[model samples]
Target: MATPGTLVLAGTPIGRVEDASPRLARELAEADVVAAEDTRRLKRLTTELGVTVGGRIVSYFEGNESQRTPALLEELEAGRRVLLVTDAGMPSVSDPGYRLVAAAVAADVPVTTVPGPSAVLAALAVSGLPVDRFCFEGFLPRKQGERARRLAALAGEERTMVFFEAPHRTEAALAAMAEAWGDDRAAAVCRELTKTHEEVRRGPLAELAAWASDGVRGEVTVVVAGAGPEPGVAADDDSLRAAVDEREAAGMTRKEAIVEVARSAGVPRRVVYNLVHSKGPR
Candidate 1:
């Protein structure tokens, strides 16, 4: 019986060839099968790193991952270590490699990772946003309605939010964020991290959107400050009720709305509930 092999999810450098780690080079040279999102890019990376891959290289991207996964699994079952590398950063993070990893685990094949550079982490580290707690939102939907709905759901997310955006869509995405999360919401647009011409712009969502309007370039990652304090805590009862009303309009029940309102306002639920019941719409 052939011993089952290991599946390694290796991270490639997002930019700058030197960012490639020695361990990554070693893995590329040692793996029995190298599955790459873009074989051309993989070749370029190997050449730049001065490392020759000692294995068969195959394309394993979105278009053919389904058909290719079974074949890759066969190699693993036959005791061939399979190394998965995306074009940039880590695999399965808004990239290919997730399905194979899931399959490997199901077959009891050992799966490990060679952690390296990540654009998401790189953007976050340099964005200067609060990172004690944050969520990686990957990419927004291309459809405007779907994108708006997605942003709406995150409207109340208190944790810092991270997102990837293509250079072309960067401006539009920022505009949509401004509309959904409030134009005054704090945000940073990180472009081309770790590469020459890298730029990070920090300001309110509206300001960032307007700045990108002139046509920004390069890969983009956006970090937006979470929703700030709930609306109008210092205002009268009518204002508190209005905040709850907005949440309820978004499909939250009265109790749920009250809880969220109070949490955001940093006040007790009882205070919000009292005001909500006493308020008359102005």
Candidate 2:
């Protein structure tokens, strides 16, 4: 006659420990098992928060996730409340947490969230770009060709796009984005957000690329404006697909080209994507 256990996904402060919610503090102190992305960082956070962790601390990161998931589920099945947290932000967002969530869902285990600060939202809020409709692209592929393909896929996206990049690769990624998205595309580079050195640089992609070329430091988040309407192109499926085809042939990706084509043809990007992938040439 034991109560069913619940899994709690807690969002930690991205920076500034004061941002930690009261619920986070209560969960950290009360959960039966606490799974953290980095135990060392978790200890530092708890120390900063001046709160003591009463639950058993366990490491749950990319490297050990597969091996540890089953064990965590066992604790849950035993009616032990398990709290999942990442070093920053919510779990499963370019971080560890997806697999366990999927497994939990499959097992019908109850899952809940304690939302808090997020780099994605924080960046978008200060990005000076349209936030009403935006897309989170997380981190792009590392290889040059792969990265190009990814950017090209998003070429015509009209909604603001947010991305996470390593400081070392920001310049190159910006450069590639400039080429795929056009040099004139407006973008914002948020560095060390919410931290003492937090900086937001807004400009065209080309300008951002030039600035980053000298090298930058700290965590980085990028927000780029979506493509504007193109003149002259008729708003028909045929013209749209042709436009995308032309861009792709010129080295743009089908994804990137489709967006650009959609913008030009005055159609939703999804329509273009569907037409571009729809079996045969139109």
Candidate 3:
């Protein structure tokens, strides 16, 4: 019996086609089965590389990933080398290859990766911010309330945060970030990375928010400075009570308002509520 073939997750260039590794070209031409997130894009890539795919080409994207994983795994089990490629960057990083990779691992199939261009690292490197302790947040939630809640949770995070956002919603997201993270905090908005119109704008969150209000085009990534040292404010009973009252007056339910104030003030929500109703809402 022939040994089972390996499952290869290959990375494609984020923008420039010349950035594709030679090994990626060879693997694309030689694999027994080629699974691509966008087959049309793969065809274009193969045309650029001047290589003809000798293997079977299948579409594997977000919509079909769940249904396609089993089929791909069967080919790998049958000793067919399966190469997975995404439209840009590595497959499975906020892309459509995780299900297949998980299936391959669960079936005891060997899997490997071909490192290639990554917008995440590229944006971080050029952001003029500290990279040693940075975190990738992928993308923010789309809904206004959900996005605000997500940002609220990160208010106390110390690691610099990176995020991807659509051009259309960049202004709203940045504005919401400013409201949650403070207007004066520093950030960078890196756009059209690795492309001809690449641009990086760095400034206070409020300023970026205002700039984005007019609009921004192309792909975008944002890097934000982490929450700086805690402010020298006392989180005493009186202060906590005052904050809860402020939020409650602004429209949040009493419970919701307490949590919001506690998070922003860097104190426990329960501690604030206890201070408010020590003998139960007089």
Work out the TM-score per prediction: 0.81, 0.81, 0.80
Best candidate per TM-score, number?
1
Superior candidate under TM-score, 2 versus 3: 2
Where is model 1 more than 4 Å wrong at Cα? 229-282
Model 2, 58-86: lDDT tens per residue?
A: 99999999999999988887899999999
- What lDDT tens digits, residue by residue, belong to model 1 across residues 98-207? 89999999999999999999988887888766777889999999999999999999988988899999888999999999888766666789988889998999876778
How far residue 227's Cα lies from its native spot in candidate 2, in Å, is: 1.9
TM-score of 1: 0.81
By descending lDDT, how would the candidates be arranged?
A: 2, 1, 3
Residue 169 of candidate 2: its Cα lDDT?
99
lDDT of 3 by residue, 34-104 (tens): 99989999999999999999999999999999999999999998999999999999999889999998998
Note the residue pairs that clash in candidate 1.
Answer: none
In candidate 2, what residue range of length 10 has the lowest lDDT sum?
Answer: 259-268
Two-way TM-score contest, 1 vs 3, winner? 1
* Candidate 3 similarity to native, TM-score: 0.80
